[model samples]
Target: MSAPVLVFGWGNPSRGDDALGPLFVEAVEAMKLPGIECLTDFQLQVEHALDLRRRSRILFVDASGTARPPFEFQPIAAARDDSFTTHSVSPQSVLQVFEDLEGRPAPPSWLLAIRGDSWELGTAPAPSANANLRAAIAAFTAWLPDL
Candidate 1:
């Protein structure tokens, strides 16, 4: 059998917008695609990096404060190093670690980042962000058929 397609969502749920990543994973889970594994976490870890090494393809969903207004959905080919200074390890760093341990041939990966506002506790995503999230989901769903 081929390696599975993994959809991983990472973020802190209590931190408003940071919850977008895990939320997206839940949405994807509802679709119940064969060969697709859904994993959600508060943040990316070394273990998660190892898990990614075994996949054929990986889709990472997260919220980004750097993104422009109205939420933006773009395919990220590489994770950024700056993520190390942030609350959690960046996806790129995780992939790099996996490569160092596993000797390359890592799965193809993509990052879907949603622009977010109001990351404080007890807060929710702004209305514009909510709409953007829905659009992002629709776009992601359309891409699945090709996979």
Candidate 2:
């Protein structure tokens, strides 16, 4: 059966700290947890809204320079903006799209932002960022049970 929990992690793997989101998805996948699905992408796009169908909960994981690592998680309400009229969209915009097309509210959703200090292309992740990433994986893994 398809998993009810959907985690979509997006970042450019070629960039240094930008790889954190996809890396988290990989760590979670290695656990082989039941009833959870992990997906990775380079960025959030308009078409991603279609992925929300039948999901129980959704998480958009991304690397953020502003996040005070190991990570930050928060609920995001569906909202639309004139800027979202473009091909790409924010997680909130995606939720809004899901609701607009599905004729109902999107599933409960949250955002997970992993802090990264460097985003230079072709460079490796800094040690500090890697430590933060590991901590986030451990912390969130435990917290998932309560979701």
Top candidate when judged by lDDT against the true structure: 2
Relative to the true structure, how large is the alpha-carbon lDDT of every model?
0.77, 0.88
**Tell me, what's the RMSD of every candidate?**
2.5, 1.4
C-alpha lDDT of candidate 2 relative to the true structure: 0.88
lDDT of 2 by residue, 1-147 (tens): 558988899998889999999998998899998888999999888788888888999988898999986889999978987547765568999899889999998999999899998999998888888998898888878878887
Off by over 4 Å in 1: 1-3, 69-87
TM-score of 2: 0.93
The residue-by-residue lDDT of candidate 1 on 1-147, one tens digit each, is: 334898889888888888888888888889888989998998887667768755878888888888765445544444447665667787777777677778774677787888787688877766766776787788788988878
Candidate 2 positional error at 124, Å: 1.6
- In TM-score terms, candidate 1 sits at 0.86
TM-score of each: 0.86, 0.93
